[model samples]
Target: MGAQEDTALVRRGYEAFSAGDMDTLRELFTEDAVWHTGGTGALSGDKKGRDAILAYFGELYSRSNGSLKLTLEDVATGGRYTIGVQSGRADRDGKTLDQRTVIVFTISDDKVIEALEMAEDTAVASEFWS
Candidate 1:
């Protein structure tokens, strides 16, 4: 796919996520996709395969009681990669978490094969999620 198409696909994926469209999100990823959560915290880990990644999403939903929301600021692509700048907010246990995040996606054949997520403040995010 072209760079513009890749960015569009990534944008659509973010839209799906924000809209709680899990089916669309699933369709954007390859069957053997992997997700890397970057941080030195309990929530940091690598989830391999589409099933594992979706299960992680389930865990996040349960932890946040389905109140988490993501807002995308921008998306760009180069070669086979796409980068998304976004912010996420959620309320859990009477505490609110609002953080800026950058996610890098590796795309192949118009599908996301891998994703690596980085947060603006890992320690703060860890505390909030913990």
Candidate 2:
């Protein structure tokens, strides 16, 4: 896909996530897609396969009592990869998680095959989610 298409796909993924449309989010991923969360916090890990990834997100939302949110700030695409900068916030256990993040996506045939998520301040994120 061209750069525009690649960025558009990533944009749709963010829109689906922000809208709480899991079905649409799943449709954007390949069947065997993988998702990784950065930091050594409660939500950090490698979730293999689309099913696992979705389940992980479900757990994240549950932990935050449905208050977790990610707002896409920017997207840049090159070759078969896209990088999305986002602002994330969540509340759980009287603690709040607010951070800038980057989600790197690998896409093939217009489907996201892999994602690696990183926080601008890993230590703060870990503390907030711990």
Each model's Cα RMSD: 1.2, 1.2
* lDDT (tens digit, per residue) of candidate 1 on 33-115: 99998776677889999888888787777889999898999998887579999999989999988989999999999899999
**What 10-residue stretch in candidate 2 is worst by lDDT?**
121-130
C-alpha lDDT of residue 113 in model 1: 96
Model 2 spans > 4 angstroms off: none
Predicted candidate 2 versus true structure: per-residue lDDT over 18-100, tens digit per residue: 78899998899898999988889877888999999989878878888999999999999887679999999999888888889
Model 1 misplacement above 4 A = none
- Candidate 1, residue 45: lDDT: 80
Please give the CA lDDT of all the candidate structures.
0.87, 0.89
Query: For model 1, which pairs clash?
Result: none
TM-score of model 1 relative to the true fold?
0.93
Task: Evaluate residue 3 in candidate 2 and report its C-alpha lDDT on the 0 to 100 scale.
Answer: 89
